[model samples]
Target: MAEQCKISAAIVAEEKSCVLKLDGYSRAKGLLKNGEFIISALFNVGGHDWAVKYYPNGIKDHADSISLFLLLESAHAKDVKAKFKFNVLNKNGEPVSSYERSDWGSREFVKKADLEESAHLRDDCLTIRCDVTVIHGKEETRVPPSDLHRQLGDLLENKDAADLTFQVGGQSFSAHRCVLAARSSVFKAELLGAMKESSAGSIEICDMEADVFKSLLHFIYTDSVPLLEIASNKGETDVVMAGHLLVAADRYNIGRLKQICEEKLCTHIDSNMVATNLSLAEQHGFSRLKEACLQFLVSPSNLEAMMASDGYEHLKSSCPSVLKELIARILPAEYKAAKDIILAI
Candidate 1:
């Protein structure tokens, strides 16, 4: 027998959508007569030009209704078949299925009287969404996922084209000044702006550990923190590392990383770590984290346990005002009044 081979092909439909928001619908109705239309701005979909025609008083025959039509505007385009749907959007900007119309070209979309009374028309405005799916008689090709971050991370790991070095906690770290400057305003000012470190070959970073700096560099290169991911599986270490990363992020003016660290610390609050987290929050003026810490301290048992924790004394000495705020948060009005009177005496 002869060997046989078969080829496979699949049809693909590329979909795109545009929304036409008709503001001042009542004004449009007053300005445009029946059969007259307002054409939407030309939009491109699947390599073909398209536009929507909105008739305020409807086309000639359907005078009582609002009309919508999707027109293929490419001048020389031929044999381009597409499926389209016109949807009347509700008050919350959601499509109402009852008002949906699917067609090849024109549609008398909604009755003007009905639409005027419905929630779909609000603030003298109405929104219509048109979805077009262009069919192609060819197989779709697979597109690979983006690896830009991976490539950048590889560059960092290989230390290729490094222009600056940081001496942090007695350890040396190589980095690209452009990359650091691009990621952080503080780094940008220090490395590129009129600062002393801008001209220095090696800069010393104080009050930050080498490991924390390493993790920060990873985030700068790859926009990720594998250290934080790994730390999440472990308990106390995760909270402690997140707190450290939060401070480092704030110092470097890395807003997203700081938010991520703050969120992580907020979720990981326990009696043992609450005092330390509270102190950090107070010093950094992190309102959300401070609120989370105070909420954790609302329980009498948690408060007692936090008072006996290792960080309690540090929290007291470093942020006495925060402790006073904590007392006000957990105390009743009458008791607070009594305490205030006693202090006055």
Candidate 2:
């Protein structure tokens, strides 16, 4: 005899709620007469359209009271069963009054005189919270996680339907022209615009390393960079790669990638990398990265170490004005410390 396993499931009700604030409540009462109503903006609950109808002065015979109703806005919906609650909220957003109903019905929620005397109405405004629970006869299936980026990454790795080639630092890379164009404005212009290289079979990229170009293509296809993960394990290589990739991202007009590189460099600031990062920030007009570098240099040891680093001479040569600005930034604190010492003496 073979053993058997059993599966079980239960019906679940989907619940969703929204808050509607009625500003200028006094003005609304003056403008909207008895039996006249204003409907809240349409909202979605349980994949169906719904809205709240507010009667400033009560409808029909309940003229002295305020009325509220929930409407099913889906045109073709029939016999849709739902349990809903209406609550009037106080200034602190706690419920002051609560009422529950099933299906659909209008309630003379509160008398106008009672509302005016109550704490729920304040500053000429009123807030209502609507809670909706849609009952379903059967359990809904769970949705699977998306693998779009993985599929695209696989396509890039396989070089499937690749239509363009780039030669960078003696290594060749193959890619789909449409994908590149879609991700980068510079690529769009170079590949589809009137540029001379648009017609070329294989274009040569100068001044960029093979690995940097490879990572750039990976981001273009998958919207991610494995270099960040590598940064956690192999520190200096990924940081250097990020600097080169920042330049490439700027060249290609890829805003998001440029931001990612800037953020990575900002977080990885050190004595050896500060001068180079400052130079890059100044050259690229990256205000946030420049600010981070300046903050890092505020420490005397960090500043001293940065000046002794290999890239300091390059920074001084390429950006003499920035060095002057740095001196100006440092002098005030030094002067304050000197003045404090004099007072102590």
Candidate 3:
């Protein structure tokens, strides 16, 4: 049977607009970044000043747009530009600092920063905000589009304080409250400067390790670090080589090298990998390998399921306590729940 009923259709839409004041800007542009864009640019974003690089969407009516901010972290008089490169230029252009370049890899990062609740920070990065309508392909690409960058510049001109100081590799410097000129005396003195050699050894040949130091120096300067220098035609697992790799990674924020070490640690999470990654992870405590091991211990399944099964006995024999903890946690919660339900039934 079919029944007829009254029907009506209508489309009602309205355009939304807001003033691009500093507060409004902080609110809008804070939504754009995908977890720390070119951190080098972080010290320069935001202010009551001229326009900043923020994207306001018009396509899907506030669906998407890129926004960036400069965040500064300081501890006991040291500045850490806590921004990670998230934009295309640094992926294709020159990077400013290791910190700016230190997210490991671009595609692997997550977290579209929503600063609505945690917008306030004494050491927080600069904030940029924009609202883009969802329907436009890229509202920002349209030239002469309404924007606030000029306003950001104007505000920056009058501001007296920077976001914070910057510390990179191990050196430290003060961040300025300016538009970060494409070229600057400060950058020349800081970023493009040279390191003063302080080794007591002669510039002449010395020891086997000094040569490795020379390699580190070359890489920190040119970003062209040499591959693992196996002294012999044969390959050997030298802890010193891993140390140099870590040094190169620390100085340049080379994510591939870092991942290689991390995977090397995970693959051999054997006592050997544990011993090595423990030191490296302790040195760099913010790394995720710590969580990786923590999760691995409590993993619902065993690595045996995915790999060959010769080494479990060796692991059981070496670190029995750790092995027992791993086995206890790996047992599925479903197993216990099913056992309990069977008794109940």
Candidate 4:
């Protein structure tokens, strides 16, 4: 084993504190209906991960109060040794209440009815300060980067001694069987599992377009989509190709690529393409994309012109369910019929 060296106390000790401000606290009122709303992410304090949890209207038995607690996220080899201080700040940036403990374990920091009053919960926002000092902890080893991923990407790009060839839309693309198998389970089953294609040297794919297949191959090699790969004089082609790529990705069980295409389609959606993209989203069962399309159509500014657009009929014919969702959003509950809602719009 390599010899270890220890630094002096002043240099060895590392303490971190953060002022967590929960803004728009009222906007998230519905979430508090279930239980406490914990801060979404972990915080680093004295080289240890910690979390702050908040109960907007307090825990079940403590409904009159707002509760806050400090949580030690990582499993302790022994009982974690630390000191903690919790402070609730008022709107003027002054602490209304403060609590401190030395050599403490995780526990509830505050439970107070004062938080419900305007002085503590000003403008529907709350701010808290947490300080932590770790008395004992071990350092974590840093991870080293592996060159295997880079080598595989380079090999795929150069078509270096490729072991398999894929014929997509009559276009031949060469890649390593192992690399494809590792990135996608669909490819894994086709090339390495008991499927008949495993024994074959060349595989044929007819459903996906040549350009979309190329994009899928690119994602398998690099874990990203190069949007400029199929740029054409008509800007509309990029959006259309991304939609096709998303479908191909779903077929191949490449979730990340599907998400990438969904986000790209969302950014490029407009009056001309919203209907087609919505239909694609509905067909693919992508809720985010479907929601985006509904939001665009429901907006008073976009609805009038979008209804008159050329693609609107295609959207209605293909994804009529989304039209119901639009109607629900725009019209009152009394107007139940789709025709009435359409006329109201």
TM-score of each: 0.58, 0.56, 0.25, 0.52
State the lDDT of candidate 2 residue by residue for 1-345, as single tens digits.
Answer: 001111111122233777778877877788777887778767778777888888888898888878888889998998777777776766677665222222254546766775675556778887777788776776466675566775787698779998889999999999988899999999999998999867887999988999899999999998887556434445566678888999999999999999999988999999999999899989988889889999899889999999999999999999776776676666776587654544454
- Relative to the true structure, candidate 1 reaches a TM of 0.58
The parts of candidate 2 lying over 4 Å away from their true place are 1-139, 333-345
**Candidate 1, after superposition: displacement of residue 73 in Å?**
52
Q: Among all windows of ten consecutive residues in candidate 1, which has the lowest summed lDDT?
A: 1-10
Number of backbone clashes in candidate 1? 0
Tens digit of per-residue lDDT, candidate 1, span 1-345: 001111111122243777777777877788788987777777778788888788788987889988888889899999997778887876666777546677855546777876765556778878888888787776366575666776798688779999889999999999999999999999999999999999888999888999899989989998887566545445687688889999999999999999999999999899999999999999999999999999999899999999999999999999988887777777787797865754454
Clashing pairs for model 1 are none
Q: Which whole-number lDDT from 0 to 100 does residue 137 have in model 4? A: 59
Model 1 scores what on Cα lDDT? 0.81
Per-residue CA lDDT of model 4 for 42-145, tens digit only, reads 76766667776666656666555555666788766357676676666655666542222222322333434324423466676667666676766564555745
* CA-only RMSD, every prediction: 20.2, 21.4, 21.4, 19.2
The TM-score obtained by model 3 is 0.25
* TM-score, prediction 4: 0.52
Best by lDDT: 1
Instruction: State how far residue 154 of model 1 sits from its true place (Å).
Output: 0.9
Rate residue 83 of model 1 by lDDT.
72
**lDDT tens readout by residue for model 3, 261-320:** 455444445432443343455456525655566465453343443223443455455544
Arranged by lDDT with the best first, the candidates are 1, 2, 4, 3
